[model samples]
Target chain A: MTMIQIRDVNKRYDDGFHALKNINLEFRQGEMTVLIGPSGCGKSTTMRLVNRLVSPTSGTVEIGGRDIRSIDPVELRRSIGYVIQSVGLFPHMTIGRNVAVVPRLKRWDADKTARRVDELLDMVGLKPDLYRDRYPSELSGGQQQRVGVVRALAADPDIILMDEPFSALDPLSREQLQEDVARLQQELHKTIVFVTHDMDEALKIADRIVLMKDGEVVQSDTPDRMLRRPANDFVRTFIGQKRLEAGGAADVAEREAGPDLGGFVMADGPTVNDVMVTQPAVTYPGRGLAEAITTMERRKVDSLYVVDRQRKLLGSVSIYNVMDSYGDEDKTVADVMMPVRYSVQSGTPLTQAVELLASHRLHNVAVIDEDSRFIGLITRGSVVRHLAEKLPHGDNGEEPGSSTGLGPQGGNREEHS
Target chain B: MSAGLSFFEFLGERLPDLLLALREHLTLSLIAVLIGSAISLPLGVLLVYSRIGWLNSAVFFLANLLQTIPSLALLAILIPLMGIGARPAVLALLLYSIMPVLRNTYEGFRSVDPHVLEAARGLGYSAAQRLLRVQLPLAVPYIMSGIRLTTVYVISWATLATLVGAGGLGQLIVSGMGVNQPYLIVAGALGAIALALAADLLLGWLESALGRRFGLRGGAAA
Candidate 1:
């Protein structure tokens, strides 16, 4: 069913800037339709029309077969969730209060509002007990955006408008959040109109991709169809030749070789920096053996990298080495640590890193920057998980830790130290 | 040495008169600031939302004009209209108080982050709701500073009220100058200074307390 229909909509600003030109589009229920284009292409303007943030100068926007102008704009907006690139989490409000904004506006009782706030926070992986009372400034950029997303979903609106929501995030967090949105959409089935400039992001999460240019949509098609059969040269150029060719080849290979072989079709695969776990278990070399063991125990890792104050990787310390020196209270991590035998540069290809890990029988390899600063670690689990995410069916029931010597402990160890 | 001793003796004798003058000064300053705030706050808010550009400029022009007028000259002008006593005195102080409060309130509302306002609108906040819930709370620091400045201005200007026979601390200074009594002028000047300091201190405390509640620190720039 068509949830929103923009019929021949044209938008001209008061300054006489024609922002949208006779654009017509329909957003289906339970499908994410991404409006993608270069800057000032009116993709954001088109999304705003659905929520009445931008009123059309000519023609009408209809929600559920009724003209949007007929309804009060404030009331209409309340029924449609909106998230922006800046995240716009009210700095003054606590995380819980921020998430409860729509619910409170709709006049939900305190009990229900509180429960919904907690539920939404938990849904986005923020523990309500820990984050509820904290202010937005206390959170990192990615965490604040997570709050922004949950705040939009607080009222459980059937329609959501996302205006370049994840573009400001780092590449790793951006990918993680893209996956989160995809997973949430699968579960909630909301009609989402997402506007972004990056075609890769649109292709990753959008069920339908609407390519726009100069205030007009060039093509509106499924991600697969748009990649395989671009409507025009502009669409082809915008989607990029590399992605187009890779996507087309992947489609054919998926049909012929089935889902398991789908991960290898892309010749321009991810680099180490794209797939490596950025926050790995690490400790200072000056720390005593007892402290090193404590750090490993707290991080839930069998081994940790020992770095100096500048985060220059010096060596690695296994739990066994710490246990062996447990009797000697005077011994430090510098004494028991083994020299770093294997490492890769930050932008080294994942295929090469995978080959090194497989050939050397190493559990994980350190990823270093130009200055030899310990930036990330590519464990066997990270490689397997990255490959699993690439498959059409993302959750392939393949244990990321099954083949690694260190078991599940060698997966991803977030740095809290 | 004798003059200083005699000054203390004089203060003892004129204690009731000094107290009466202090009360008058406090009353005049309070009434002018209260009425000034009553007029300027809503006007400032109106200016923030008003689409008529000339109207905003005209209001600011009038306020700037008022501020440029000498306090004694303003009182002299007001006497013919309001005619003596506390009324003319308060009218002058009220005019003087308008510019600071009005400018601050306007700036406070205008300084609210546009992105936050956009989010509020996107989340379904009505115009009034956005003003009251988001803009107003965020503008509290700037507004408080404005009120503090207005209060100090009014209190200091109230000392000049005695020229119109309003009989505040200015009466003591004027009479002492007429009679060549230095201690009288000192006592009246000290009283006015004390009142201004006290009012500033109290308002400063209130501003910081409100600032903390609103998630601002050290109040916003005046």
Candidate 2:
């Protein structure tokens, strides 16, 4: 069901800046719709209209089939939650008090408000006992934004509006918060209108992505559809071709091959562990050069990872390194082994790991667990084989600019040449 | 040494009169500040929320004009209206006190982070609620500083009330000059100075207490 319908809305500021040009949109219940564009494209303006933060100049916004203008703006706003890029946690307010603001405004009982504040904080992974009494300044940037999210959820509003809420955070914090919102939406099922300039963020969390440009929406589609069949050249370019191919590959492959290929459909993008070689060739560091060379030959590998008794990766001994030290009778694998340079954490997205490999021109990168203990290895062969199995026919040539592995400019192409 | 002893002797002899002057001086300064704050605070808040640009300009212009008037000149101007004594003195001090308190209150509200106000509005706080709950608490430091400034100004200015027959500590200095008694002049000057310092210290303590309670530094400075 459509929870919010913005019908033919137009907004022109007093200074004669026409911010929105006859926008029409519907936000479905229990779905997140992201409004994205370059700066000044009116995405923020459109989102603001739903909350009556910026009212339409000409058209009407309806909430649950009733005109929003008919309700007092303050009352209407109290029924919805809002978050902004700055986090905007009241510095003077404790985390508990900040989260209780909406409840207090709605005149929820003191005990109920306190319990809700604690529940909301705990929901966001912030311990109520540790963080409830702390002010926004006392928390780190990520923690503050978590508080901001909980504050929005305080009153249990059925709708939430987020305007670039995580944009001010560092990249790691931003990604974590994005996942948090996606997870929260799964449980809460709130109708969410999120506005941002980042396409990756839009794709990561949005059930529906609205691409806007200069006061107009260029396209509105599911992330899969947007990636596979871009509405126009503007969208194709805006969502770069590399991302399109990577994101759409699995879906397009599944569609062509039908239900039998369902087992290989990675609805979420593949992670490093999905394609990593769990049991790569290993050699003890104290082993002689001949022994390491024998291990590499037996495994049909060019290198062997040297490890201690605990299976913690010490370094790698390559065939060439073995040859260089073959004449030294006393030399062990440790004496000639090169330090492992490129490694990724276990759950990292495959595309990022692949980019790391392509950018640095590495044959393989080690995958480590949280303890920094080696778990597996993601090699070029593993990735190519995974793609071949998923794509099946190697018929990705239909897409105008599609290139396998990394892209035309990637080091993977250099290896082919 | 003899001069110092005589001054002490004079203070001992005139203790009741000195105490009376101190009481009158304290009363005049305190009353002016209290009334001045009651008027200026709301007016400042009104100026902040008022959409009329010229009204804000006119109010600030009148305040600035009032401040520029020489203290004795303002008393003289008020004489015809209030007719001398404590009434005219207080009216003059009240006028002087308005500028600092009003300006600070206006600045306090204005300097509140726009993002915080936006968050408050988005969370469904009414305009009045935003003022009382968010903006006012965050602006406590600035408002306290304004009151402190006004208190000090009113205290020092109240000494001049004796000019209009108000008979504060200033009368001791004026009468001592008539009798060629330097101890009397020193004593009156010292009393006014002590009161100003005491008031300033007390207000400074109050400002920090409010600042800590409201988390003012965290919000305003951060």
Candidate 3:
């Protein structure tokens, strides 16, 4: 059953501007639909119309097959959850009360409301006991956003409208919140209408994406279809062809290799990140060389990536480097570690990564996120394994001339590292 | 000059009368402020939500117009209508208090964060719910500051009621001026000033307490 149906909707402001042209769309039950475009593209206006915050100038909007204009708007909104980018928690209320606003308005008893507040907070990974009594000012930006999401979810509304809820957060926080949203959709199966201008965010979160431009939807399709076939030049630029190409190439590879390859296709091609080890042995910069050696020994690795508590990449120390500093009583790992100059983000293509590693004669490159936090590492071995897996029928298993460019001794030494 | 009494001796002798006048002055000031607040706060809320700029401007214009008249002039103007007593005196102070309280309430409503208001609206808040749950709580700091300012002004202006035989501390000044007793005049002037200062300090504490409850940093400072 369709959760929301908008037919022939047109909105014109009193200032003689058409905010939305004749739009006809249907939102399916239990799906995440993202409305995305640049500013003034009517995404938010469309969302507002569904909640009856703004009535359409012409045409009709129906929620659950009932005309929204016919129903009381306040009652209609009570059954719909709404979240925004600003995370507008009432400063005067405690976190618990902020989450319980709608429940209280709906006249739920105090005991039930309190229980629901705690349950929702715990679901979002915030400890209810520690956070419920605190004010909004006491929370970090991300924590407040978590509370905002839980507040919207408090009433267990079947439909939710989110307008760029994570846009105000830092990249890491935004990514985490995006994951939380994805998890919520998976677990609850609620009908969600999300509006954002970020194409990547739409691709990551949307079950179906509605690409808009200048108050008109250019195309509406699944993420895979949108990436494969853009309806127009505007959408093509909006999705950024380079990113599509990267995703498209991997997808094509997936198709040709059949479903047998399945998850391995993403790892075998496209980005160097495809072949990276996400949980490489990590040590802090202030540790003693003895400690670094022990960590490497425990992890069964020759080198340890050094990072601060925030996971900021400092450098790395290999077994050979630590051995060179043997018998040093007071020397910390920072004293023995080689400065890490070669690192790659997860988006770097496999070919570029291979060239970088070959040119620099490096055994590995640390993978860091935009914030320079160590995420993983792409090694010479993983790249070789991915290449080996990509070959159609190279099952002869002749060792593939270990180290494609390095000599025999060089190959063995690289293998040892 | 012929009266051989020191300032301390005069204060000691006139302390009881001075206390009675202070009590009268305080009663009149408090009553005016309480009544002014009761009238202005709701009016301010209505003006803010009315969404008619012209009506809001007209209301503000009339309130401000009343404020521009001198307090003595207002008292003189009210005497004929209310007839020389605490009614005329309290009514004049009430008119003077309206400007600060009403203006502050309007400003407080206007100054509420638009984003927070939008969030409240989006989350299914009815008009009354939004006003009570979000707007009023957030605007309390600004509103309290306005009430504090009004209370201080009312206390200061209450002394002027002596002109109409209302019998506040201002009577000492009037009688001293007539009889040429400088100590009586100084005692009455200082007492009125002290009352105003004391009301301000007390209201300031109340404002900050309200602010602290609402997590606002500058409630008392305003």
Candidate 4:
């Protein structure tokens, strides 16, 4: 069902400045649609017009098939929730009173108002016992924004309009609230028209993202489709961050590990424990190749343990770590060490193990078991030799990232190309 | 010091008149304030919302214009038209009372955050509902504070009301001033000052108590 329909809506300010021009959009019931754009792009104006905060200069705004102008403004307001960037909590009122303001204005009884206030506080992960009595001024920006959302949620409107509600919060707080709001949307299935300038924020919470620019929509599509196949260069750049670690994700993902690694690795159930080094030589993920190269040279070890904070090896480096030393071994580990997300459990299939290394371009992968206890290791030299003896690379360019093993049957080498 | 009277006689002789005068003083103060707040509350909201757009500037201009009058002259001006008694006294107190109430009311409503107004409008509240629910409630502290200060000013000035033949503690001081009785003058003066102090304490207590109970910010800050 179409919860809100905006047909050629235009908003021209009193000064004759047109903020939105001939816009057409529809928000479906129980789905979350995010509007994202650069500043002055009319996304915000579009949001304000839905509730008649700013009336359309022409065309119609319809909620549930009827013209919004025809509904009594008060009745229409009680049925829609709005949360804003500033949170806009009435500092004079306690959280409970703030939440109850709309219902009380709708003339709800005291008993019902009290119950609804508490319910909303709880729904927003705030304990009514503690938060209900506190004034807005006492809460942090994030807490106040949540209270703001609850206030909008108070009357249980079928549609919610949020305008950069979490923009003022710190990164961690914003992420947490994003998670909370995403969970809420999943559970409640309320039709949401959310507006934000941040693309990452839009991606995190929106089921469908409307990429807008200069008072017009450039593209509107499902988040996955938009990410996987951006319509244009603007979209590709806008949605670029999700694939922020782009080229490497396909190289590192278990499914996209190329075939060369599979041809060389040991085929027998040679678990990571049997061959993995407990302490080949340790190095910080930082310090580029300097520490690892020194550890390799000084300790006279072929490879160094690139264990993370937990002392679990990420991947090992040998000639690869030294190969870069001639250029600048002093570079930070984050700059040089291959970005790896794969760590296999011991006793895994040789094919599965081969997939992990080729995708990430790791010379070797640490092995663990069911309990994630470190067990052993596997190498590209061994895995590729194994794959070359197994199957030919029929589909070469279809690198889907998650595919374990897909590469030309050739010798494995540490090279960017 | 009266040439023949002792301190006890001084106290005893003036006590009854002063008490009666105090009663009248308190009465004038309350009546002026109650009326002042009633007028100023809506006046304040309009002063803000109108923004010089809808209504003529006359009403707002009058409120600004009243603030400039001297309280004594206002009482004298009202005396001839309203008669010399509580009516004239109350009228003068009302004039004095408006400056603080009107100014505070206007300020309180004007100070309401624009973001809040937008949020309320976005939530589907009509202009009227936003004013009542969002703006007015948020402005309550400033409004109460305006009236609170106005109350003190009204009561303090009501002592001057006795000059117009309105019975209040000022009557003792006026009569004492007429007879050159220093003790009586001091006594009446102290009584009015004490009443003002007591009023401040009482109003301060009431503002906080109500703010706590109904989610209002207390006083001018509320």
Q: Please give, for residues A256-350, the per-residue lDDT of candidate 4 as tens digits.
A: 25443452233333344333333334566765565555655444334554556666555545545456654764565545555345677765665
lDDT of 2 by residue, A1-417 (tens): 999999999899999999999899999999999999889999999999988999999999999999999999999899899999988888788888999999999999999999998888888899999999888888999999999998899999999999999988755466679889989999999999999877667766889999999999898988656665667768765764223222334433444466544434444567787666666668898899888767654444557777888878788877777888899999999899888877899899988887887778777788889877887777664564445345433344443212434322121111110
Docking class of predicted structure 1: medium
Lowest summed lDDT over 10 consecutive residues: which window, candidate 2 chain B?
B213-222
Q: Each candidate's interface RMSD, rounded to one decimal?
A: 1.0, 0.9, 1.1, 2.2
Each prediction's TM-score against the native? 0.74, 0.75, 0.75, 0.71
TM-score of the second chain in each model?
Answer: 0.95, 0.94, 0.94, 0.86
Most lDDT-accurate candidate: 1
TM-score of 2: 0.75
lDDT of 3 by residue, B57-157 (tens): 89989999989999888888888887888989988889888988998888888888788888888888999989987888788988888999898888788
Candidate 2 CAPRI-style tier: medium
lDDT score for candidate 2 against the true structure: 0.81
Each prediction's RMSD over C-alphas, in Å, is 9.2, 11.8, 10.5, 12.2
Cα distance off (Å), candidate 4, residue A204: 1.9
Where model 2 places Cα greater than 4 Å from the true spot, the runs are A241-417, B1-5, B218-222
- Tell the DockQ for candidate 4: 0.37
